[model samples]
Target: MRRRGMTRRSLVASAAGLVAAMGTGGDAAAARTARSVRGGAGGESVRNGGDESVRGGGGGEDRFARGEMRGVWVASVANLDWPSRPGLTAAAQRAELIAHLDRAVGLRLNAVVLQVRPTADALWPSPYEPWADCLTGVQGKDPGWDPLATAVREAHDRGLELHAWFNPYRVANHTDPARLAASHPARLHPEWVLPYGGKLYYNPGLPEVRRFVQDAMLDAVRRYAIDAVHWDDYFYPYPVAGQVFEDDAAYARYGSGFPDRAAWRRDNVDRLVREMGERIRETRQGVRFGISPFAVWRNAATDPLGSDTRAGVETYDDLHADTRKWVKEGWIDYICPQIYWHIGQSAADYAKVLAWWNATVRGTGVCLYVGEALYKAGDPAQPAAWQDPAELSRHLTLARDHEEAAGHVFFSAKHVAADRIGAMARVVADHYQDRARAPR
Candidate 1:
């Protein structure tokens, strides 16, 4: 998720101060120790000198070599992270992408989640959607080369797993269909589109819309050697304040058996996840499916099974994404919840939430990777904890206690590069001394 505006100078100074105070010469030694104790991805366990055992919720043991998923999200919507901005030459765009990948490798990270489809558009050649506007500043205008294809090849060459990220329903940031490409699917099928909260979305209620989106996203999975298929938290467009999603027509048409509108919406998202997972496996047996959902599923005050959080928004109730159900049913290969909060936050403490998710994925055969808010670190608008360079590093230190906490993915690539508060560098110094492969 994007954040409020940030000035780089002060944050940089803060990071420098922290580094100066802590000293940096011992980072290499610390990392070596971490590798030895944690066992570099797929390495022999330090304890039993054999495969590491993952204790399941049902008290079963699933054995595998210990590995961590150290990933960073490269957002493409509105050119937030890559291409620098729209209309850059293809050569320039490729250079910027290569730089991001190189930076990830330098950081000892193992995975890259590139947003190929930010809105209802494609970053590669697709029969289902037009070219992403972030590539050339004009929807449908080819950017002279395929970004996804290049990303997959370049990332793999650098020994990094490239996960193709897609936003399932978001069509456009604006409500005007006229701004879209002439052959845009949303424009082609008006009935499938809905204007909500100043943005346009393909109504999730329609069966055809769901199937078409699955087809659109799965196209890349079939065409490229992508490591995984990834989806962010935008399932139903976090409830708009005072405005409705306005999917009544499709709901009226297909909401026959569901308990209510919320249930029907959740079922729509569930079908998308379950069916997409099935198709991904069929398309490529080795390809994994994952979702990085909003951290809280439901506050304990609302549901007995929910996390002990007082979060204002719940994925289950507000966005109609039954994140917990998806994990229990094993619909996704991994669940990386965006626990974007501080350690001791009153509303939703990071440690408490991490524990909740650690338990949620246990025994389910699904990997759990915490999504870190790299963007928040040192941001003046954020809470005081974010101002501390050690804040993000502390998050990793905290995750070490959870057996199910396989790894973590930072919010974005730009922050990884900026290391504004030296937070990313602090994390590298403190926790990521040894590079770990993404969990299988």
Candidate 2:
């Protein structure tokens, strides 16, 4: 088969690796995806990053997880992807969103993890918090319609599962309570929020804050037919240099029983994850509750069971997100760790991270999906390896070797649409040669 846009270097290396088709654009992307899904449009063979006979490579018959959770994140904060910018008419907003879902389906992906709660605010009309600034550029002003409801309808129509992504404790990207809506939960209960790293966050250590955020998010879950309730790697937020999270007042008030502050913080986040899981199951029996945590749980230097990498941050240590424990205990239905690194990365090898995560969820019933960094590919700020169109594809190639690596979710939607340097094209040709089912 012709390489199409594939660069010769990657094809020689064995090579590497859109839309809810709504209109013309959608039709084209969907056509490409349909061709791959329907037995590779005549069972065309693909040469993948030096592996000629691997899954979905030759005869396109060995594709994994036809039902796997293939997904992409549609970030709303700061106008990263949709609406192009904030304050678009409700009609325009809906169109942009449908376009994203169409893009996902066009790429043969079955899921879209859109950020409904970008910064402790709602993309939809919610009683818990005001409409997100990401939608109207004004915290409280409603856009006259619910984005989440529209998203569910459009996504389902395109045969894509919609995962409502929430940031449990984040209040705002800035550290000002007065600027918030008058009835905003954070403003009303300033004591429940903590200013850290120039940002405002609902104090995870506060019991009231935890329950309130859960309720706020669950309100949306109960109202929508979303396939999953998703949380990103922001449980306690990454640490800031020369600054400490001033939860001492909270710790003193509620953490007297724990042996230390770290344990108490871990317990706080643990409750959020555990209780959220239980509530999601109770509210919607099959609505999968999942988390896409920071890739590194803990460095092996600190814990032998940790991955063999020297990431500057650890979800368990700094962010207080016990990602591993959640998997072992089955507190989450799936763990989509953001292993956004290239293969052979010195600080965090994509191959090693995947293997570590594979072992992390081995027998736990929790599904495993590595969060790929499509956004990193070809970005000048990224390491030199990311400049290669095949780097991201190589990561997927490596993942095929791991039994527990169920699937992958790309970082964001725009990168896939860009197909920078043909990185995404390489992947479509290699692994996603056929349509697959998204895991529940």
Candidate 3:
């Protein structure tokens, strides 16, 4: 893929409307968040950092209920939901973040899974790679402030846990390296990347590649006040239509005693997860580690222990992410499967997967937080289960039904902003109205 050239004016025009909708830019709340910073402990505050005075009636009633790991993903690629556009000014960017936090606090969300390294870049000051293109027009141009630092401080003032979400293997959303800045990791170390599925990714099969990615992400955990090291579902890129992953070279070089390539890839990810978990726990004893894997582990026909779904792509067979293994072995602190499908859909049924995950994670000492499909909550084009106003609420109901299922995190932040299904409003009014103390 060739690099697409863009001018700053074009980016400004593209994002102007988005910036306007982010409200009057800043308010007294924004000023409070700004003033909340005070360089004290663990880079910032612990999770669910909210006001101590505003006590409501609902939180205590739900104390017997499983405490949720509520959060929303703040995606930066293509400027999906944050920074408005590619070249937002640093002030505008900070304002946008404040608005996001305000929404998070308003909805009574316990955490914010902000994307720190969406691709092989940084949202804050970093010595390893350049600034994210999503922050400024130019990739390496400094945004004049540390977004991670400010976010940590402000989020803590409001008492929200900030999990620095990292895309472990994703290098770029596009396939062009020349488009990236000269200092971009892909440009600096071209051999470490492999272009596939219309995007570039660090080859998960290589030992050095695995170590490099782990170290780069762990560097953030070590340096910042990140409450957790969170990873999304980009393990071995979700299968391309007809193309095969181009990792034969690494497999040939490193697959020396493994049974096959599949096992080797699983080993590579497993190694990354285990080592990263151990490293984070060692560096920050309170930092939690979690993974949001694709919903189904495997079909029951494929494996007797797997969920009863007909999904074409299973986490184990296709992505090589043995998520069940992670839960069973107690490697992850929590497991959030993206149960995006409806109740009775045959492809990947939500109820079946939830039951399976709930049963599997009951006593493993790993918390289970179902990843609700907020985007599908009330879409008329979707199945009847989705169109129901209580669709997501029903999922939350299912979460409540489970022994180990604690809480949920919506897919993207923008969805919660829409008030679709009225689920966010419902949770706040009914369950999370008061500030429940943080989990011990």
Candidate 4:
């Protein structure tokens, strides 16, 4: 099976105007994603993420802030990057997680964005959600240890920030609720669930469902002293060919005079983003709320403000995620757009997208982190570009040209340790030689 990777937008005055039109309903529910583009597309060197002196890994516990974000994701779903497999003993799981964090430190990264809630479940026991099936291979069964607790302690000891990751609306990877634990929220409240593309998602359009999902996620926030609240590109699920997300009933019941279903759907996601941001701020003043959205917000042909990419699947029209608006409205602390393509690729050129995002995040107080696709490195199945030993490093080299390009986060942990084709080695040599804290 193919492993799925991460993917994210743009600017400020017109943004406020757009938000005003979207209505005050989003005021309480939005994520902290405001942004602006005062500068043009060229990148100046950023401070925390240095460009010079790329050698040596013994940058021993640098006391000063680097002002850049160097993070690695430790995905837990289906054992993509951790635990090796489901149902591992509690001691074994703890050891595996610690090893992943140690690997991050070895690579000179300062943050571990561990997925605490992959697929609408919790790594830490939660009153509102079931124990993650990814850990024990059975929903609601404890792995006999609190992964989040161990992660926070270990990451902090290494001077790394532990960002709690959540997949807000996903209930199950498959459509049937029978496979879910009997006490799972989806099974208890089937009305809030919708099946599309063989997966069950809590309908984003339903106000009650949105609130429930938020409350469920916030349970973790109140329980853990996490550095940030992180989400990925799963807002409305990637568009499936010939398959429609059946939410006509939701639209008819609550869309309330919106001209089209698309507008209503986008508003639903907007509310979720806005509210989550407000809640995070209220709960923990410094805890960041951020997202790693799909690369293309829209093709240039689709929207005059869109990036110059032509591949397909947009965040706005297809996934109902207004990525640009989130950045513009100050609904997120950071936006990590997974620019997982080669420098000169035909569909989505990495250089072009990087320039566009740097320009977009200039004045918004929101940081920009490039989501590097380390998983693709040295993979023969990938495009010929990734086959090059220096492909990943070249991405870092290009990012150095953008001032807003605060730092880079590799897709998952295992790939970085594997150093496939020595691609990761090249990136470290060229960009991460000096130990740096995650960009604030």
Count the clashes in each prediction: 1, 19, 6, 28
Cα miss at 195, model 1 (Å)?
Answer: 0.5
- Candidate 2: TM-score? 0.86
Q: Which has the better lDDT: candidate 1, or candidate 3? A: 1
Q: Over all chains combined, what TM-score does candidate 3 have?
A: 0.85
Model 1: lowest-lDDT 10 consecutive positions? 40-49
Clashing pairs in 1: 56-363
Worst 10 residues of 2 by lDDT: 40-49
For model 3, give the 10-residue run with minimal summed lDDT: 31-40
Q: How far out, in Å, is residue 113 in model 3? A: 0.7
| Cα lDDT tens digits for candidate 4, 324-399 | 9988777887899999999998889999999988878764557788899999989999999899989988887777
Which sections of candidate 1 miss by over 4 Å?
1-64
Q: Per-candidate TM vs. native? A: 0.86, 0.86, 0.85, 0.86
- Candidate 2 yields a Cα-based lDDT of 0.77
Q: In model 1, what lDDT does residue 200 have?
A: 95
Model 1 per-residue lDDT tens digits across residues 84-112:
99999999999999999999988878889
Off-target runs (Cα >4 Å) in candidate 2 are: 1-66
State residue 3's C-alpha deviation in candidate 1, in Å. Answer: 36
lDDT of 3: 0.74
For residues 62-104, could you state the per-residue lDDT of candidate 3 as single tens digits? Answer: 3332234667888877787788797777899999899998998
